[model samples]
Target: MNGVSEVFSTILLTSIFLALVFMLLPFSYYTIMGSVAKTEYEYVKHGFYSIATYFPMIATGGEYSIDFPSQYTSRGYIETGRIDIYLNSSSQPTLSFPCMALTQGASVGGAPRGLLYGVDTYIVNDSRMIPRIYEYRDGNGLMIMTLDTCRLLLDVNIVPTGNYSGYYYVLTYYNLTISFRGSGSLRIEPVRMYTVYSNIGGNLWNITIVVSDYILGKSFSYSVIDLVKMGFGKEYAGIPFSLTIVVEELVVEV
Candidate 1:
């Protein structure tokens, strides 16, 4: 009887020990898996954090593009004056990109003088500045002096808006050239002209303008007199000074 009782007690203790180990095995596995998942989450968050700070610096240089990991899906858009990038739902986004403008180069030639650098624009704006105008008086009242007595060339760049990734160039120039000589008399009148050309996007464009000395009304009186004479007088029979130009737009695909 004593031997049987000891065997029974030993068997009971062994069974209890085995059951406890079985329960603890599952708990141990769960704890280790939880720690690994937390570590992976932190790594992904750190990667996105680094990207947010790096984007601003690259944007200033030019257009920036990048591809994300294949396992996750992402989306990018500009909203409320900022660019937002969203990665997978589980990961924090690499977001908040700075707004960047598309840029273009503008160049103006002074005929024989060559290309002027100081007046050029690396990035386009709403209103651009043209080449400097140097005026002097001779026997001919006022005239637009040219480079090496040549004509004036104006090169304009129509900068793209939004995400248009392409190359575009618009070239316009005045064919007329003026030489200041004591013999020539300055004509006080309004000069009207227009430039017609296609844009990089293959669209027709016409720009009409009236050139006059607004500061000195001297030409205004002449313009009025000419208008009166146009009714009957020969002085205003023909358009005093007018120019019209048309050209196919110069587009370079890059």
Candidate 2:
């Protein structure tokens, strides 16, 4: 009878142990998955920050590359993403391009948040009444004057002349948007850049910078006169002038 009692006690203990493991299984799995997702999110965010911080360099038609992990978690995968550039206080974007990012499996902390970078405003003072047409590359188009911290690309067929001219200074206002996605690694480069000029008023002009790529198929615009007020004249010490709106699409390869 004692041997039978001992056998029963061993069976009961084994049952309890198995039940405890089953109860903890889900908690352990979720905890591990959450940690993994967070780490993946951080990696993507860092890649975006690097692109934003060195955007000027990349804008000069250079290649920027980053490693994009295929999966955030066992179930989460990357989808389409994009980057947008807003100049000044305008509600619309002056420049935009396609990017990639994770878009599924919300149970594992959802997708990463988008990134925003504020660009400093600089006054570009050109002594000539007609803005100097910088050097034109063999095939790259016109390379505009480089600011204190950034370079601008503009393609102009009609250069301002006569009364519509004076010492001009352009106020630089810009911002950036970055998103992510894909498997293995990715390379981003500017495929094309061009600008169109329109005479909106006597002294005020509309400049549109258009960038195009495979994934981008939209256009957006905003006026500079609404953001900052200034006059144009050779008599004034440093008259603010010229509104530049940039629209761009880029090639991103995996």
Candidate 3:
């Protein structure tokens, strides 16, 4: 109290000393620490967002797996499992994906060359492309390729109602969640048979099939044809042609 001027001078000296210390610090050290902390924060935020958005997409993938049977084993675990992995690479993944198939002369050496990218699906209203097919092996070991022949038994191809060919058109599309209904043990692989022939009743024709699976048509329903058209209203007793039918996620027309 006796020396007000001296007290002001002492406070000013202390403040100047603190400012000088801050200025003398190495700028790089602060810069490095700040960058690291910022990166960490951003990573955590983006990770959370990705997790939320991707969960729905994975669910969509599962909905299509509903056809598998019960009691399967995987990864040393004796439990039913479903796989939904997101990928854009060539690596064979741990995810159990269903076999994707296309028509003849496209797939070679067990790999399919397709015209479109990403998930392949068909919609009926899209008249530009034909409908997809679903051919399950029949008792006679034939892939039934006539699903649309008798769809509702109305006036259509193969009149008077016939067995459904494995081929069909998806009347609509579903962007909804993909949910799989699984059952039997599920395994996936790629297999190809270049040319196969049938000798029924001494009939001769060239038959070729390409499939990608450990066990092709093991659980499928098939049908054998005694008579098939050879074009121009001429049918053959045994006309061997490579055939394929792929069952896909379908939504009925409203």
Candidate 4:
């Protein structure tokens, strides 16, 4: 009788131990998985925010390739209504990148206004407008575009004339990183020109350049002529005449 009782007690304790382990297994798994998922979400969020700030710093015209987590896909655009970047996400880990442009006065209308973040406003007048929209890709691939600078020169070789139709404007690029291809073309558009005499006058212009890259999401137009136009004509000709540009540099940010 004593032996039998001991055997029964041992059996009962073994069964109880197994039951307890089975009960706790699922709870342990649940806790671990939840923590892992939360970690992933936080990490991805940090990366998304970083992109919002980092992009504009390098958003000059050119091909760009950025590496992101394998699970996410992102695209970027410059808002014309206001100076901001709107990021769109389409994937498992959805997200958005939104922020003001590093440079200011980047509006749809080509009129020059305030400086963007204290940086000089480069594009001015009706000639060049804000780059309305653009996009990016996942897995950090490649971006290629033409980058150039529009310099307002008080003195240049351009002869001032009433008709001024006979003079051809040359746009020379300085920090150009990518080569021209496909339907890519450089065009000089006349925005507005005011002339006092032949050599003394102001001209507002819109310079447009086309870039072709599958990596880039869309085509955009913007200029830096306005930022450099400030404080120059204020000294000369009572009102001052400012409308001369020299293509200074060629390169885009990545």
* Most accurate candidate by lDDT: 2
Cα RMSD, model 2: 13.1
Report how far off residue 199 is in candidate 2 (Å): 3.5
Clashes of each: 3, 9, 36, 28
lDDT of 4 by residue, 82-195 (tens): 111111221221211112211111111122222211112223332222222222222332221111222122332334558542222222222223222222122112222333
For model 4 the local lDDT of residue 141 reads 29
Q: Name the regions of candidate 1 deviating beyond 4 angstroms.
A: 1-3, 61-254
- Give the CA lDDT, 0 to 100, for residue 84 in model 3: 25
Name the weakest run of 10 consecutive residues (lDDT summed) in model 4.
100-109
How far off is model 3, as Cα RMSD?
21.7
Model 1: per-residue Cα lDDT over 70-153, one tens digit each = 122111111112222222221432332222111111111122222321132211121122112222222333221211101112
Decoy 3 TM-score against native: 0.17
Q: What TM-score against the true fold does each predicted structure earn?
A: 0.25, 0.51, 0.17, 0.29
Model 2 TM-score (2 dp): 0.51
Candidate 3 deviant stretches above 4 angstroms: 1-12, 18-56, 59-254
User: 38-60 in candidate 3: lDDT tens per residue?
Assistant: 45433332332332234234223
lDDT of 1: 0.28
lDDT of 2 at 65: 88
lDDT of each: 0.28, 0.39, 0.26, 0.30
Better of 2 and 3 by TM-score: 2
Instruction: lDDT for model 4, please.
Output: 0.30
lDDT at position 235, candidate 4? 28
